[model samples]
Target chain A: DTAVSQTPKYLVTQMGNDKSIKCEQNLGHDTMYWYKQDSKKFLKIMFSYNNKELIINETVPNRFSPKSPDKAHLNLHINSLELGDSAVYFCASSHSFGQRAYEQYFGPGTRLTVT
Target chain B: TQLLEQSPQFLSIQEGENLTVYCNSSSVFSSLQWYRQEPGEGPVLLVTVVTGGEVKKLKRLTFQFGDARKDSSLHITAAQPGDTGLYLCAGLKGSNYKLTFGKGTLLTVNP
Candidate 1:
């Protein structure tokens, strides 16, 4: 079974358009995260939610918002998509927070292209 | 902000060759993790090291955590074409579950 899965694996939209990427994990994890991998392949964490509570919010722009309806799902919504928003978005989940050996499971990733 | 820096951003070698990738950071961490990502896919965890000066082996791959918990290394013996991918190292600080990831080292094993 796919432990972590993401929908809309490929999203292509024009500038100023809005888009959303859905993510779900069956690992029964308490924490879920959203990451962005730019063209240079630098992966950076944008947001993290623990049991549907926002825990970490990096210095990302307000245009990007992450919503977790429950502990099993986390979704990212982008407003006024720009060319710089074109990158791969990955969803990840972990069992809990503050564990020394916490391992995160990642989804297949969604490639977003903002034209 | 804590940052992990991986050395030799890119490596290209022939099959059967051995290589070692380094992940270094100035800030100490409670744990370190190594991941391998293939093209068009998300990264998959290879191993996690929690103790200082700890070493773990998975077949031909060996992972070592630094004594100070600020660095780590991954050694692959007799690499095959399947080993070609992007290798990333992530560190976790005390009480912070967020991971600080390195830029990653891209390894290309040619047959």
Candidate 2:
């Protein structure tokens, strides 16, 4: 079983379109995260939710919002996507937050292309 | 902002050779982790070092944490083609739940 899974492995959409990427983890983890990997392969944390509570929010624009209906699911929604939004989005989960955060398990990334 | 800097952004080496990748930071960390990522897949955890001057080994891979907890290193011995991937280092400072990642080092092992 895939511990972490993401939908829409590849997404190609036009500029100014709205898109959503869904992520689910069966690891029974308490914390879930959304990360963006740019063309340079630099990974940055965008948002993190601990047990459905927002715990970390980076400098990401308001166009991007993350929703966690429960502890097992975290979804990312991008509105008015721009060309610069082209990158790989990865979902991750960990057993718990804080000190145990390093042992995160990541899902296969979703490649988003904004034309 | 806490940042982790990785040296030698790209490396190409032959099989059976040895190589080292370093991750440095100016701020102290409570723990540091090393992850390896292959194409079309997310990163996998290789090792996590939490103490100063601590070393951990996983088969042919050796990881070291700096005494000051501000840096870490990954050394591979007799690297094989299977070892080729992007190596990333992430650090957790204080009680932060997020990890600050470094720009990864892409290693290409030629046979």
lDDT of each: 0.93, 0.94
In candidate 1 the C-alpha lDDT for residue B103 amounts to 94
Q: What is candidate 2's lDDT per residue for B8-111, written digit by digit as tens?
A: 89999999999999999998999999999999999999999999999999999999999999999999999999999999999988766788899999999999
* Model 2, span A1-115: residue lDDT tens: 9899999999999999999999999998999999999999999999999999999999999999999999999999999999999999999999665555548899999999999
User: In angstroms, what RMSD does candidate 1 have relative to the true structure?
Assistant: 1.3
TM-score of chain B of 1: 0.97
Query: Which parts of model 2 are misplaced by more than 4 Å?
Result: A97-100
lDDT (C-alpha) at residue B3 in model 1 = 87
Residue by residue across A1-115, what tens digits does model 1's lDDT show?
9999999999999999999999999988999999999998899999999889999999999999999999999999999999999999999999774452358899999999999
Candidate 2 Cα lDDT to native: 0.94
Best by DockQ: 2
Please report how far candidate 1 places residue B3 from its true position, in Å: 1.3
lDDT of 1: 0.93
